[model samples]
Target: MHGWRIPASVWKWLILLMAGGLAVLVASELHVGLGARLPDGEGSLRVTLEDQLGARPQGLGTHWLTVAALDPRSPLAAAGVRPGERLRFDRPLDRWRRFAPGERVDVTLDSGRSLRLTALPTPVGLADRTDYIGRTLIVFPALLFTLAIGWHQPAQRAYRSLSMMFLAMSAAFFYSFWFGAADGPSALGKLVQLPLNCLAWYFAADFALHYAAQHTGHLRHWLAHAMRFYRPLALASAAYTAWFALGHEAPWLWVPSTLSIGGGALILFLSLVDGWRSGRGDLRQRYRWLVLGLMCGGVPPLLTMLPWLDWETGLGRITVLAYFGGQFLTYCLLGYAVMRYRVFDFYLAVNRVVVFGVVSLLLLCTFGMLQHWVAHHVSAGHSGFGWQLLSDAAPAVLVFLVFNKLHARVEHAVHAVVFRRWAAREAQLREWLAAIVHIRSSDTLVAGLAAALDRFGDHAGSAVYLRLPDGGFALAASATGRFPPRIGPNDPLAVLLRADLAPTRHQLPQDAGVLALPMCHRAQLHGIVLLGARPNGESWRPDEITLLADTASQAGLGLQALRVDELQQAVGSLHAQVRRRSVELQAAAGRRRFGMDALP
Candidate 1:
């Protein structure tokens, strides 16, 4: 039923009503039906005595008893009276002789059965009180906690956890009612109890699974399987308990149910404790508190089972009230945990809390004042001007304070965690660009350039191919990879060069990579520099584009200077070799003429 497709908020109210009903039922059975039985005040008392007893005992004094309302056929009925036998009074007291309302009396029956009943002025006691407590504070808060956690998380896990907890609590309350009224440890009792144990088991196990998956050191595959085994085992135990209780001896009926419920509960507690200890940060602290709340919540039910701990006639009612208190505390803690941990980004919780808290307070106050005014004249009742002013102003103030704090916190956290990394990467890029600018030799320059481009495959491979005086292009410098083969007069780059335009960034045709800059020098078009795409396929950012342009300009100047210096050195060396050879040839000719005269 908890799994049915209803709004969580609606389910919350429903659960509250059901829990209250269960508490009331339990109180009625234990206090009025089991412990005391009083005469009906107005309608049935006179007729019931006339029909059942036939003739009343003589000189019998009238006694009054006020009994709480209860189901007719319950364990207490079986304990004191035989099936189908009616209680017979010793004397029939006249209806007008009855005690005043809100009075208690003990009545003696002819069959020696004595009954005591206390008057209920408003049919609202411990059971109703528990119901109100759970509805207003516990169930509603639990729903809020679920919404806070589920708002931005993976839906499946959140849904499972919420359903499990809701159903578990529901089943537990339902079973508590049965345990009080069931006769002779009936088979039906066992069947009813199974659902409760199974729900509780699955809820705890699923919660642990979800929590563990988010943190480090998760259960291994086999261990996870074992953990999952808890659900079915608990369910099976419930089934077995039901089957055995139907036919087995009374003492043995509750064994399986007790084991399953106790075992699952113990394991869940251990898991919560372990998780809280190992976890870190504010999230962990919040979780620890939540776990503590859960553990505390189990105490009331456990106490109810202990005979020594229970008080007299209203023990069942007191036990239920205590349980409701635990539930309230647990739900509040869970909501707090969700908000503190940023489970779904606490913004939504903050907004809802601010809005609802202000609205409800104002509305309730106004309604109370209006109700009094309706009974008496407006002049005799309290003024609602203060209520109206608060309702109008509180929401606005809450919105302003909440949003302002949220914005500041989000900004600080983002700047600290995300943007600082980006800044560091940018600094590294600048250092690389600086190195490229200073390098002189063509080979060294290419290697450095290659290293820099490797950081972003923004340029796969590039080369500085200068247009020579003969109109052919020469490879001046190159990075590691193969150069583009088509580098000639007919190429598109040559056409751009002949047109004599300033340097610009261009993309090649048909995925033909990118060119960051067309090298130019001394007001003349020098050559084309080719670049390729980065691995991530991201376009260069504006700062990166500017850096690329600067690097290209510096490289062009270095290439021009190096080329001119080498050419001048070559010419001077050639002149020296030619002059020395000519002097040698003249000396050889003079020696030959002197040899001819000596021969004559």
Candidate 2:
């Protein structure tokens, strides 16, 4: 693979592009207008009704079907008409005429039996298409929010979650458009489309709780525990949606949406309550602000369902808009938390941005291809600008996404390998400098240098040898800080070397190998330090030569102090011995004088 991949910035743009396309599709569908879309009914109770009255019928209320009259011989024949049941037709009759099938009549019959009927020619009324606007407004921004959150704080456990949540919203939008334009009577299609809104609702709640937790540290534990329950809740939501769509049960849809969103809100409430009860003032303050936002963002959608709201003139659409707005606002706060708190870090954010962007772009391109194929091949020459718009955007979006991923990966790799290693070495060198704080004598200097050498063990041993005035050198300290075998004038470079002389380095061979560094003090050469191969026979780094030279200079200054102390101690000892010898001679003289006087 080429080194350059995608970066996070590009990934975000990709999501935007996709969401924009989805929004466009939704807009186009809306512009087609409700009058041109909804099946014939102006204050008429004509729902496109189909009753496939099998023993176990599925997708019964999914699409628009003409309700046929009940067959008297059918099992549900005795029952009367029921709600959502209507008369059917065999073929396209005249405008506004009562629909009729040739031979068979199918009816709901108040007992919920179904039969096939003829198609009808009916005019479509104005459908309140305001819901499309809700989808459009939410889809792109939510996608951008999700991409942003995931890219910057991917490891925070919220990243995957929020991305999936927005993706679910996108999925819902796609289904809505697909169902809106479906040509045939599709029970399966409606069955599939029916649950998308509910699922999107669940994802919305999930994304919200996670995002809130990210901001309010007090809520994190509760949110984490709440997240653990998501799998079960998701399964339940799916099950409920299936039951509602397939079983034609209203309560099934109601149960999951209420339970999932309600449960999330309850969890938030408890977290807020606990935060308030805590005596810590700062904790209470931050949490209260957060809780306020959550309520504002979360509660309205559920409350809008009440009958006092007069929901028919597109209040359902308003509810969604409230939901999206609240979620988007929370997304902004969560991003602020990430930046202010450094919740995860830059790399994770970058990684997410790149991956999400590239994937989103690819998906957008794929959708464009599918749309083109459908428009050209399946639709058979019927053309629309929507397909053209999506296709034109595909190539640019793909290129932008791919480059973003590449940039992020390359930067992360280089930082890890090169920059971090260099930083570590520099830190070690600083530590060695700190060790030389209180140096009273040369021994301390030697010991410090030995410790530093241990850090570079690939080199076998180090030795410090001071030069004598006579031009010979004596070993002062070794890697062990012990005096080694003295090198008089017999060493390999003994003839070529000088001490107190030229400020230069010279290597000399002993019974072992030769690696030498010259010690210079104030531009004066003091001695040469030799380091032998390590016991493991490993080679030292080239930088070690410079490091050794620096250490030797410090060691040279220490050696001067040692030499002075040694000379002073030797002079004092000689004086004391002379005094004792003089005293002995005096005693001998006194005894000789006494002997001579006695003889006289």
Candidate 3:
């Protein structure tokens, strides 16, 4: 992007599209299939997933089911099930996937009692659906963003690595969502998922290492050394996951994952520090955005997934959603990064997504949390129907009322604070535009433009070329440095301005360190604004250039308005002089016709 062009690969795009479609299909099946008649285990059961109760029996491979509500209609209740009681069968629950409809299964209770129960699939509830939706929301953006990067910069090695890393991370989340065990023939892919999880951490760390190593010089040598073992470590971790899947008790599974993530985190932190310390301008800003996104996206999962935290304490299904909320924030940050880095020429798309996506996510997330909190205080079983309905709808109602206002504030914050330089300048330009309308003098217009140009540019020396009556321009106002006193109508600058009103490099003396922005209204060229180079020696970005050109457009319109005002004033003065002369002639003629009056 700095100089060379990266061509998009057609085959890569087709593959990405196919993969995205498959993902959508899989997610839809998982979501819609819930509570539907299971072809194999043709039954239904309602229970919240909770931790194992007491200890597993010596013969009962692992605890299968727990946490049953006292629903008399449930198949489990017919087996005399109680809350917090462990339910298992003659075999593991994973093997019960093939039971026919109405097939009898024997269950062993925690009290050493045997009861016959029918095989049942888990029931889908609102909470379940919410959790499922939230998880989808979490990983969806990663795939989309990965696809975007692949489409935009597939040729870049760093970007390709970045896309792969994001894809792996999303895959890991897909397997880990709901935190359920692989308990069915349908879930046989969980064996592959274990290895995928480990790959996620490895790829994340490796990508971060490479990205930082390339950008920050201090970390290059160590990062290169780490890269030497990158493939080996990744293969080793995958092998360990396979061993774990094969019923081997390998505690070392986490060791490699931890080492990879830890290394990556360390590299990102150091790169951030080094960048802010030594880097300048846009490069430093990019490092800041990337680091911020990592912290925001990665830190919360660590907190939420902590062992000590009692997830059973009213956080049951919501904890999963909490994870979704955090991941979405990370996506927002990534959106900003992609735009800021110019990875794609789609800033407007990303901007709307960042601004509106953050707001909508927060709105829905708040609604979900409020609903969860209200349900905790007023028990659904005990509360009146009206009270229950009111409680359930309150969160939605609240968010609905404030949505417009919230979106406004979020948009304002994005423009005024987060994207200060890029968007805030537009607001300032409007103020300049307001001033330009009332003042009719060309000097005032020139002075206002020069000031605006200097203020928006980084310590810039800005000057405005005043348009003359004979279709020439003269240097009228300079906010900082000098320029050519006068420009001929036949000069190349005038010809370019008249033909097309776009900014071009100023090469008056060759290496003048200036940009020439033409001011035009309608089809008429009015003037030109000269913008100096930044003190940091970095050129203005494309977006910034566009903004300045917009400012020039405003200046041109203002100039046109001033010309119209001057012409009106001149016409009024001519009319007044004509009336006065006509009146004097009429008085002289009357005096001549009256003879005495003429003598007088």
Number of the top-ranking candidate, with lDDT as the measure = 3
lDDT of 2 by residue, 133-245 (tens): 44444455455655555555444433444454565555444333322322222233344344544555455455445443533446557665776786478567766766655
Candidate order, TM-score descending: 3, 1, 2
Give per-residue CA lDDT, model 1, range 1-600, as digits (tens): 323465655555655554444444434433432222221121122112221111222211122222223334432233454333434222222221222234443445445677654333232234433343243344334433433334423234534464446544544433422212223222232244445555565566556555545552443333356656666677776565454323332233345545566666765666666566666543356457657767767666655544455453442345556767777566544443333333323464363463244334334433433432332333233447775455445555554666556555644553445335445655665676566546556557655554555444434565566677766566655654556654666666666655754343442443334553656677666655656554444434344445665666666666666667656666877788778877887888889988998995
lDDT of each: 0.47, 0.48, 0.60
Model 1 alpha-carbon drift over 4 Å, by segment: 1-137, 143-154, 170-194, 214-229, 238-253, 312-318, 343-347, 350-600
Model 2: CA > 4 A from native: 1-127, 151-153, 172-231, 246-253, 269-297, 313-600
Give the candidate order by descending lDDT.
Answer: 3, 2, 1
Q: Cα deviation in Å at residue 149, candidate 3?
A: 2.8
**Candidate 3 Cα outliers beyond 4 Å, as residue runs:** 1-7, 18-22, 29-134, 177-192, 206-215, 239-251, 302-312, 316-325, 336-346, 353-442, 454-541, 550-600
Candidate no. 3 TM-score:
0.58
Kindly provide the TM-score of model 2 when superposed on the true structure, using C-alpha atoms.
0.37
Task: Give the worst 10-residue stretch by lDDT in candidate 1.
Answer: 51-60
Q: Residues 1-600, candidate 3: write the lDDT tens digits.
A: 211343446536743864475365445434323323221123444443343211222211233456546566667676667787776554433332333345566666767888776645543344544654565456556666666655655665556556666666555444443322235323443454557655655555555554534456665566557656755776677777667555544554456755555555565466455654555455566666666776676665555434554254333433455566667777877776655554233455664564456556556655655665566545445568888677667767877887778868877776565467756666777787677767768667878788888877755788788689998988878876667777789888778767767787644443233578888776777788877767765556667778888888888777777878888989999999999999999999887889975574
